[model samples]
Target: MESMMSFASDLKSVSPLTSGCALIGGVVVLLFIKKVAISAYKTFLRPAIDFTKLGKWAVVTGATDGIGKAYAFELAKRGVNVVIISRTESKLEAVKKEIDDKKYGVEVKYVVCDYGKFDTKARDMIAKELEGLEIGVLINNVGASYRYPRYFHELPKEEIQHLLTMNVDSTVWMTEMVLKGMVERKKGAIVNLSSAAARYTQPLLAEYGACKSFIEKFSCSLNAEYSGKGITCQCQAPFFVATKLAKMRKSWSVPTPEEYCAQGIKWIGYPDDIVSPFWIHATAGWVLLTIPQALTTAHFTQVLGGLRKRGIAKDANGGVSPQKTKKN
Candidate 1:
């Protein structure tokens, strides 16, 4: 009987520790289940919010090609009047004609302003064109990235200036132009095109990644500040979309611009501040989070270093970079 009592006391001694561990495990399982449920619902069940409710006119910057062009087409197809802005007048006219041919029954306007200029004159020109339009949605899609990854010191001063002006300045100034009207109207959706690079400490692509990170942070903060006013500010962080900027071909992992924009437009006016609109991209993003940060950084460094070497070799061979060969 004395021996049995001793055994019972030992069991009681470790019971609290076991109970604590089990409680923690249970909580973790519950959290995981909740996250999965939410993702499933967002991916499959939630109806796309009606963008027409926000306003009559939607403006897309960098609308001459790639993702911006795709967004313009998608919005017009959905019966929204679209103002497509880009640096080149010829390409804008071409896109406008294409939209007209589709006969989506929506007006398509074009604004010619080089976001790279980022000057008061450029701003005034855009402002003048946008005036008197009930601007509902603004897609801040205009941005610049490196032709090829390079060490920070090796990048040209001119390239750095262009990056700052095109990516950062344009987003801020364009938002300033439209946000007041949005606030007064009490309904708007601003979609800023960020990149998955923003999620990493990209080694050779440092400045480009940093600029995208700024967009992500800016969108999140703006959403927090104005969501109560019925304005949805969102930053889309897509990975490897097949576009002129990426110089990548379409695949299951890398979607075509049309495929991406189709999935992308569904996300507007939702509450999430930063999103990977495509479900595959979202899954890839989540998988990336599970990898150790050090590993991910080292992997990016190695991959980008290889690209830098190839780029330099191409330059030595008197070849133009793909980025320079085609306008993004």
Candidate 2:
């Protein structure tokens, strides 16, 4: 009887260290549950902002094709005119025609300047185009990445310059052009396209990811500063969007540009600074947030490295490598 009692006592004992870990785990789970509940409410039940009331026109950089174009179309359907900006003149004209001819019945205009080489002159040109427009929205969708996935050092000086100018400089400049109008009117919305890479550490695509991360941080601060002024600034982050930049065909996990933009447009004018518009991605995000940061980073590194290798081999004869990215 004595021996059996001693064995039972040993079975019931738990180390103090184990007890502390269990307590911490319980706290983390509760926090995660709260976040998910809030997210579900915002995503499913929260009403969207009525954009037609914001202004007469919405401006989208990189609006010739892909997500940018789709976003432009989405807004037009909601009765906002579109100002399209892209590098290629022919593509610009084509987009304008598509919108006009298809009877989107909204005014479509273009300002052609390569975001890759954007400078003071380019900024001035875009600002001039924006003048006198009842601008309600600005979509900073232009972005740059390596011809393929390249490490930070592996990227050339010129390529880095282009990436910075397109991704960072163009966004700030366009925002500067439109922000005053919004401030004066006390009504507007700004959507800056960011990437899930900002949330997920991508190893080989360091600079691109960093630039996207900068956009998210930058948009968040701006929203906080301007929300009281009647402006909604959003930084949208998505994973595996099917675009030319991504170079991957669409799947259930990867949405087409049109599909992605539909969700994105619905999310406009929401109070949230950072929003994952896709329901599937949002659900997956909840699970990922529960994971340990160190483990996720390690896993992302391996996955992105494999993607880089595959991209390099596919583009081996194309002079430039393929960059895994969303609508650029």
Candidate 3:
């Protein structure tokens, strides 16, 4: 009886509102813990796809830095040779050299191709270069966004054209170029990097988000059509990671490219066509998607509008952002 009384006294029963608030808080904490635990297990413990078993060669676009570069090295470590493509020859060569020196013990080759402007001859060259390779994996990681988000109508004509071609057309054509080889071989994995922004409306980034959404839908259908033939198409939709293209620095919210790519590589052959491979990214996505669409869009647009203002000021300082003189 004394023990019972002591326990009851310690409880110090509170008002119903206080108890209700405490209960809710506890539930939220538990849910967050569960999500974190599950995501950590998936990121660190899951067995990565045996990429070498699929083929000898892996090709990555936009491989000079960030996620693309990280994936190229990850594949090389798995004893697969890599072919990297990017617009800057110097940057590509530097990545290739880094792969070589890191002693991945796999061949590292690079192709220089710019996605901002479509070039028939360059496309043919890429195809020709890949013609004889026993390609196993294709990482369609090249992508672009607005220099800063703005209303769709406010975007410059050149910027619109660039984003459409770079973000959408490049993925389509590159996949077409590589997919036939995979189908014929009857064994391959293709990882197409999309954006989490696609899952919800991004008012200031309408076209960019739309293109990513298209990539997700396209990857799912493509996988269904070809999975029976031993091809796996994965469309990964990451929320954000610090990269030059994103114009952001690495943070807890924005994982470094290496960390993101490591988790991403582990998710190859993952059952879902769409994925947020990083732990924090997946958790943030779940939370954001639960909010009302109107609320989310309103908040996002305001944030992006600020970025647009800053971008405009910077470009003005830099003398109109150096428009390319080349037609290509």
Q: In terms of lDDT, which candidate is strongest?
A: 1
TM-score, every prediction: 0.93, 0.85, 0.84
**Best-matching candidate per TM-score:** 1
lDDT over C-alpha atoms for residue 118 of model 2? 85
Runs in model 1 with CA error above 4 Å? 1-14, 320-328
For all predictions, the C-alpha RMSD in Å is 4.3, 6.1, 6.2
TM-score of 2: 0.85
Order of candidate numbers by lDDT, starting with the best: 1, 3, 2
Model 2, position 68, has a per-residue lDDT of 97
Write one digit per residue (lDDT tens) for candidate 2, span 173-201.
88989999999999999999998888877
Superior candidate under lDDT, 1 versus 3: 1
Between candidates 1 and 2, the one scoring higher on TM-score is 1
Candidate 1 similarity to native, TM-score: 0.93
